[model samples]
Target: MTEAALTISHLSIHDRSGAALVDDVSLSVPRGGVLTLIGETGSGKSLIAQAVFGLLPAGLSVSGTITIGGHESIPASEPKRLAALWREQIMLIPQEPSAALDPTMRVKRQMALAGLQEEAIKPALAAFDLPGSTADAYPFTLSGGMAQRVLVASALGVGAPIIVADEPTKGLDSDRVTQAIAALKRLSAAGRSLLVITHDRRLAEELPGELAIIRNGRVVEHGPSAGLLSAPQSDYARTWLAADPRHWPRCHRCCDMTSLALSAHGLSFGWPKGGMLFEDLDLHLPKGGVLAISGPSGSGKSTLGDILLGLRRPMAGSVEWGGLDIVAMPSAIPPLRQRYQKLHQDPITAFVPHLTFARQFLALEDVKSGLSAARDLPPLLERLKVNHRLMNRRPCEVSGGEAQRLALARILLLDPVAIVADEPTSRLDPVVQRETMQLLRATVDQQGLGLVLISHDQPLLAAIADEHLALGPRA
Candidate 1:
């Protein structure tokens, strides 16, 4: 019998406090085949991946046998051996590309460091739908999707037979998501083994692979992707499938656009090297209106959001906030920003990492009454499905969905009149995505606040946006 490309037998991992993060799990990825792990946030999917890479948190106890490509199982505790094996054998496509790449290094040099020739790297770049010029660009200049593709390219350059990608398509728009799926498909077709971990069941369903359903550190279900998605046996899997956005009930709220809220006129933005990203672009979001900005990756959606929120200045334009020209008043920018909040793609980074959720919430308000805050915050927290138990813990201790909802709650507490949410639901599961967007939509209407939703998701935009702007290359 042919040996599996990657195998984990009776794997268990425990935290310092003796809590089992991963309980006795067994899985395998056959050579040239794809295996996907689908689970909710905090279900131990990432811990499993970390275990395979021998990069688990300090003080954690691991009892596992991990074999790669017919090699004997190596104890995961040996850091030097695991580090060497990791570099030479198992290629990891990390969750956040921006964090993985060196900001100072050129993409070409980084790929070269992975031990691949330019000839070998070019095709991989092309396969991932990245331009040849991407190799010459700095990590800071690449959009989230572009950076993600570069990471994939770097892994492919190493020519490792086994690839482990964690949330590879997280925060991408539909276009970038499609490109990522295509790239993964191409990689698997070329006889490389893949272990993809994601919360996006839609992504799992679309990929050509077997599927494993994990919940609370256990694999509850395992089967072919088609069969599992079509008729999931487990209750959690069935609930997850039923909650997919494609099957979600649609009831879009109409925005009240009786008065002007925010507007940008003659907006012309140009990067230092890229020249003009957009010229004379006009945008308007009325009171209680939603204007979704949709575009391909690297097409300046986030840049436009930055300009609107005063985080970045446009080359030539006037942004009017409630009839006041923000560009004309530099000193007022800071105060006005409080009223026009921005929600980033990664909510955790948007938060104060050192502060607990309760502390963060208190910081938003002028009222110092703890009793009042305790009485007021829980109902809203419950509405958003954020556990009150997490209030004591820092942002890093919470899941992505929880962090995102907490961020939204924070913005709402500030009593903002307008909001610029950049891909707010991109990292959440389908159920959470629907819930969060619906909640956001309801909040916008209830507060009569203007919302500029920037994303690449056409279906999501269509579902909630009252107005749409499609961005593309310059004329």
Candidate 2:
């Protein structure tokens, strides 16, 4: 029999709107076992973590007891207790690793703060595919992938007995993701407890223990991993599984329609300070068509997306929008901000954190006034299929998928002649990814908007795109 390490009962959390973010939730973690908390964003999974560790933001309130290590009171009000708890026994591999990790400090210095000695830092880096020499480099100086490994490495070095990993692999590649997962298994095997918080069912399935599905703040289902995944008993579980990437279907209808909405002529673009990110490059997106720009991470796809939006000027070559050089037509540039929109890779950081959804929408409204802006909500929400009910909720109050959908909706509202999206599916699970692309495609078709999707994820592209182009090998 396993020993209980963490316990919760009748846990509930509410946002400023007084809506229960986590309705009634309860679960337990055995000492030396791994328990994954899986749920969509705004489903109260993160709140549970915050409640357990006492880390919720200001003004938010939580109820019910979160007992850790048999103590009824977590003593979260005591910083010394929280800090000590963090360094010695429990830790969080935070959801946003980049944000959690300080960009100023050197990797080795950060690792030392987590309890590892400088001499031991090399081994830690090696464990996560980081160079042994990375200890000397600052966090911002490292690549996104490198930064992620450091985040995990710092937490692991602390020798925390219980860890709450929230989307720990946000910036990691597949190989590093595997390594991180294996490391978690090793921790569990060694008598440390872990609660992996993620939306990825596949990762949840691979852990050597139980799966608990939480939705709208309740434990909707709990059972052995294999059985629950193979034959889910709950509707929420089934919906989640259906949304998994493995079950997603590609859009076949989108292929029949294509009418060139944007094209490039001898497009040679480079940095004046001189890095030829793209040189003598050419690509096109048909009217109402979905064109996916695919490649590995950091391959300059986002750079090209920014260029297309006229946010950056190219040193050479030309980009033709409707057969006219948009660079030369300074006249159309003003309206283009509304006509050409972009949804960045990360949704949470992309939004103004403190603003409520209504406030953010109002700011957008301030850009282009009147009732016509209100015209965007219904069809936009219906097409995107986001709950129109969630319109008033703050960005922090909503789920990750919901936030992504909202970001997409804002782009749709602008009704640009061309839409340039950067990795719209990277943060989403398989099912959501496919559904989102379909919605994006449908929006483009109905409005005759051009779509250019930038991503390193292939399966998503295979599902919705009319044409595929890789950056370095692009034609």
Assess each prediction's global lDDT (C-alpha) against the native.
0.80, 0.71
Give, for candidate 2, the lowest lDDT window spanning 10 residues: 75-84
Give all TM-scores, in the order shown: 0.90, 0.85
Off by over 4 Å in 1: 13-20, 58-63, 75-80, 354-362, 365-373, 395-399
Question: What lDDT tens digits, residue by residue, belong to model 2 across residues 1-475?
Answer: 7767877777777767687878877788889887887866557787778777777766576777666776555533333444546656788887765577787887777788878987788988889867666788776555455666787777666777888888766655456678878888877888888888886555787887788988767788998888888999998788887876555566645533346667775655544332455677778777777888865433467677877877776666677665668777756667656767778766766778878776677677767655354666777777666776677666666666778888987776665788888766656654466668777777776877788987655565676777887766322
lDDT of 1 by residue, 191-290 (tens): 8899999876657978887899988789999989999999999998987777666675555556555587789999988777766779898878988888
Best by TM-score: 1
Residue 142, candidate 1: C-alpha displacement in angstroms: 1.4
Please state the error at residue 55 of candidate 1 in Å. 2.5
Q: TM-score of the candidate numbered 2?
A: 0.85
On lDDT, the leading prediction is: 1
- Which regions of candidate 2 fall more than 4 Å away from where they truly are? 70-72, 75-84, 131-146, 253-259, 264-280, 312-318, 323-335, 369-375, 382-393, 429-434, 471-475
